[model samples]
Target: MDTKTVTDHLYYPVSAQKMDRGEGVYLYDSGGNRYLDCASATFNLSLGYSHPAVIAAMKDQLDRVVHLTSSYQSDPINGLVQRLVETSPANLTRVHPKVSGGSSANEGAVKMAQHATGKTEVITLFRSHVGQTMMMASMSGNAFRREPFPLLYPGSMQVPDPYCFRCFYGQSKETCGLMCVDRIDDFIEYASSGRVAAVMIEPISGNGGNIVPPDGYMQKLRAFCDEQDIALIFDEIQTGIGRTGHMFAAQHFDVEPDAITTAKGLGGSGAQVAAILTNERLSGLPAHHHSFTYGSNLLAAAAANVTLDIVRQPEFLANVRHTGDYILERLRDMQLRYPAIGDVRGVGLMIGFEMCEPDGKPAVKLTNHLASAAMEHGLILRTSRYGYGNVLKIRPPLILTMTQAEEICDKLENLFMAELAR
Candidate 1:
């Protein structure tokens, strides 16, 4: 690709190299150089690249048919919905599919919440990122992503997230009485004016540096929302489908959300599909208010069914928990050895390590430099824009083995030592 072509069209510059193939947990470039796919293409390839089951399902779907525009019903679509409902919380029995990504799923959830309650306002946590679409962008707390789209949407409010690392309230996780949850309730009381439809949250903050709240945070939010008659929406787009060693992150807290949104790993390793799962009370709303043409396409549905089957297995979930624990322990050791590592936090496979300068201020530049350096060492990692962009996100596939986790942790330690010497 030409420089002008690469630079002018895309928001980010496209690297010249092209991916040739992928298998298991590795990807190869056109030159046949293989790299360990720790990033998992933004942490979506849960079953890893080119799984036989997912591929077979898609091929079988192709042999039957591809699109059936929601005007008609297809077996795969029905089967996928049944599988989703069976795997999700008992109350979340209704499903609305979408052909877009996580952004669209968030948009759909917001619309449903509003339609069900006739409320105009919604609440989200500061530093939380829902999606990049117009409505989702408005709900997102990322200033950089929302700067150019100030009037993107209306009736979205932000509150303090339960980020114990750099607590806005100046309290440690041990001493803090979940003032963050109380703050959320206060915000709802003052901001809602009885016009709020939903309070959307990441059960465990995903894009906001994998910030896991204090124990009972989610349960408290659920109880508060119930008392206030506001819907609790869980943006599980990043934390669902066994990424957090559970079918849904809300399961970890044993709290049920009125609505939950999912995408990414839902389709395994192929097709783009997302869904908004709601309870019967929420689903009783008029159907004419929401519909999508390719929402329940047969091909995508088939892939999703297969993906859910694999992720819902007892042995598979056990593997996820085991691997996740190993990774977290290794990260904790790194934090002890490197002063640059400020905090290591997260649950299951979704983890983050905050970076800081010797003087104790967040070091955004150093974090980005480390990510670039890791890429050079054939390990891909993500940098969070939240927490002043000082957190390194490590969300590899749930299928990653213990040996692979050791390799990643060892490389990270070596990289930190080398950078400190420099």
Candidate 2:
């Protein structure tokens, strides 16, 4: 069949150019055009494309078995569980590897929270994209995502996130005394059902403009949750597995949450796996209550085990921090030259810069246009909130070297020069 026919038969729209293969951080089209993928193939691929270590591990597991029921114990699964607990925060003692992806992991984490707290309400931040599952879609903050579904999750509410650049309370970070955390009291008392079970948040929001919380925000939130007996869940799908220079963002923030949902980068070279890590208190949910058919595949577990081993290395994580700092520095320089570059924020390789109009409104159209034009400059870029937002994400593979980091910044500068020249 022709490529066009195959594409037409598919359920979703795809780019006209056919990507033939991927190696390291570069994806090559059928025409032999190489584009440095800044989005890391949906923000997974911490080890870049076809990583040798992940592939070898999967190959070794494939020789013995690929999929097995989670009811049975296996070497791969046992190794994965042990490694996850060892690498994750000290408080997260249990690992639930029965979830298929980030969505299910997040939903499972919420279920654990609900089960433990005996509460129904879940709170998230504005512009957050927790997932696309029916419950997650409803729970997510953006109105556009939940607009089509007439029946929505009832007890989910959104509070203002710590986006100091465009603060919801119109207060600066310095003198505001962290009103973003303080104001949640009003949200819980008035907007919510009062029996709030969980407050799930991304340490650095995956699609919500990559907003990083203020210095003391997570600690304050932890205290607030403790005060209210609410379970704190970190949706670390996009920020985990060395993406943030740490095994998990929870480690980076130095605040332990009640639970964490991890996926995306866990597969390293894209083997399809996810898991929920929780404290003993939230580990009461039975395996049957939140397990998928494909959840405990031995092949994926093999991949994850190797992925974790490689990512946990101090030198590997240090490289992520160094490369990320270099890119952030370069982007900050770009911000100085480019007035449209409103805000630059990130940690490790997960970075984003918001585009703004001269009047300070979101430059949504401009953001989308640049993402489209990026391919011409040998770059692959993705817009935040699946294009409803004005932030262009710069989360490349964690395996990115200093030279590759420089290349990304140079190409971005060229893209801006060609398109945004005054």
Candidate 3:
């Protein structure tokens, strides 16, 4: 490797090229090689790199202030919060800027839920990737990731996700009648002390192969949580910020959650920041209950403010929907040409298509090969398959144009026909 790495990251700058910089939906290396950013630069570059407006905003804020703890108020933070609240679902009236990414926000959300409900347990899906922290890693549905940690979080409970492709109930969606949702009570009663503080779910399981549940899945889960009086927390770190053609994925199902944790794209600038958006009812945490030193960094908040302004516009969201539809349609067409493409799923730009064997099992080897090969062809896609390794994640920047979508499709078509057809 030409560059020094500090962490065990699997994706990004994979090639032995000292990446120079990025612009729009593209990344450039020191060798001047440009690549189409198909994975949105690890699914966080919502505006893509060097977005002029975001850069200008961050620069302007840097002149006024660099950062402040959450205890102090700053204009950038206030503005970002206002924009988030205004653009969020009607029920998400309050927002708390957390001092960490998805995992921290999730942990904070859980604490708030526990505080409000007086319960310590939470119910999470079997495939939902929460975060990298121990508590989150333990709470995650990915058994392979959690297997090493024997002393995992005790209060977290697991339930089958609404994964229709491999439905846990072993029945078709038409006949199963959402047996996944119907079993929550059984799990709660049989698995826990009958006291779950909250139920956290990813509206579209991003790392779990872009698993978009059936139409009524979110609504059904919402009803169940309401009946059970458990806080419904939607982890929108991957699907939020116009990536889903909506401000939030919950809007797609027309179901509002009790809270939503956002990050990844929220910062807009390459800096990391996250927040826990909740309804007013769940905002009773005592002062200093939770805090991160840099959670409310002024620069990140400035970038996020600019990002929200640009992404929340009706025109911007419409473009995301249109471009996503174009890409999805092309991918579906590819499914007919390639037997490897077992499933084409997702909404907006947050998309994935599983590579599969002839017998319909996940083609993990081929999927991994194709993802690596994509870089050789001047494109960057993500194989964010959790442990399954068959889900080739295709989430691109929200700014992707029709031409870029077609180019990606064309590159993929060629990759499949020329390389994988062997």
User: What is the C-alpha lDDT profile of model 3 across 1-422, one tens digit per residue?
Assistant: 52355323656544555688899998998888899988887799998888899999888988988877677778988997899899889999888885668888988888899999999898999888888888888788767887777787789978998989988889898888888999999999898998899999999988888888997888898999989999999999999988999999988889889899999998775767789899987899974887888788888888999899999999999989999999899999989988888889989998899888899988888888888788888888788654366898888788888899899899898788877778
List lDDT for all candidates, in order: 0.83, 0.93, 0.86
Output the lDDT of residue 265, model 2.
Answer: 97
Best by lDDT: 2
Q: Show model 2 residue runs off by greater than 4 Å.
A: none
TM per prediction: 0.95, 0.99, 0.95
Q: What RMSD value applies to candidate 2? A: 0.8
How many angstroms is residue 114 displaced in model 2 relative to the true structure, after the best TM-score fit? 0.8
What stretches of model 3 exceed 4 Å from their correct place? 1-15
**For candidate 1, lDDT tens digit of each residue in 146-244?**
888647788988999888888999998788888888877677667766578899998877777778888888888888888878899999988999988
Off by over 4 Å in 1: 1-11, 386-388
lDDT of 2 by residue, 228-332 (tens): 999999999999999999999999999999998999999999989999999999977877788899997799999999999999999999999999999999999
> Residue 51 in model 1: shift from native, Å?
1.4
Per-residue lDDT, model 3, residue 369, is: 85
Candidate 3: give the clashing pairs.
none
